[model samples]
Target: MPAAALKNKPLPTQSTAKRSVLFDSPYAPMAKHRLPAGRPREWYVTHNRRLKAMRLAIALLDSGVYLANQAHDETIRSTAEEIGVHPPSNTTCHMVRALMRYSR
Candidate 1:
């Protein structure tokens, strides 16, 4: 969409948590470590996945593991757990792909 055509449209809402675990994931700019007051748990749940994924991606990057393809998905998940991000979900995996894309 043209920038002029997109004027007045609301940007998508993002997480507002206080991210204690800092990293260089692309999503780092948006992810926080704690939910803002008054936000519903449901809202937090929806947004926190990206933060978790960001942490996992940072761990992989630190380990020199750049994603090559889906073949890297399992490695990503294991890294997630090793880094304390348990039960890595599909959304987290998607974020990992995104991180790798930007890095490349």
Candidate 2:
């Protein structure tokens, strides 16, 4: 357990170890949580839009588009298409740019 004794040992990683059987099973029961009730329809729509925008923003950052101005509506929409998501609307594109701007 001494530091010097452990220096030559490599850390365990996913590829080097066997995971639990539960995780490897195809029939394992997955947990699903339902959203809370009573919210307006528009609230749900906007919430999903926000989530999508956030995803697109992060994708743009990953692809080297850091500035809000650099991430135009067309760029955001194209990124969404590349990532297998539907093209974002103008409002969602604006939200994505806003998110990039404030994230700085």
**The best candidate in terms of lDDT:** 2
lDDT of each residue in 14-65, candidate 1, tens digit only: 3122222223333323344655789888788867777677677777666566
Highest TM-score, which number? 2
TM-score of each prediction:
0.56, 0.67
lDDT for position 6 in model 2: 62
Q: All predictions: root-mean-square deviation over Cα? A: 14.8, 11.9
TM-score of 2: 0.67
Q: Please, what is the whole-model Cα lDDT of each candidate in the order they appear?
A: 0.59, 0.69
- Listed per model in order, the count of residue pairs whose N, CA or C atoms clash below 3 Å is 7, 0
Local accuracy of candidate 2 as per-residue lDDT tens digits, 1-104: 78876654343222211211111112222254675789998988998899889888877787678899887766776667555577889999999999999998
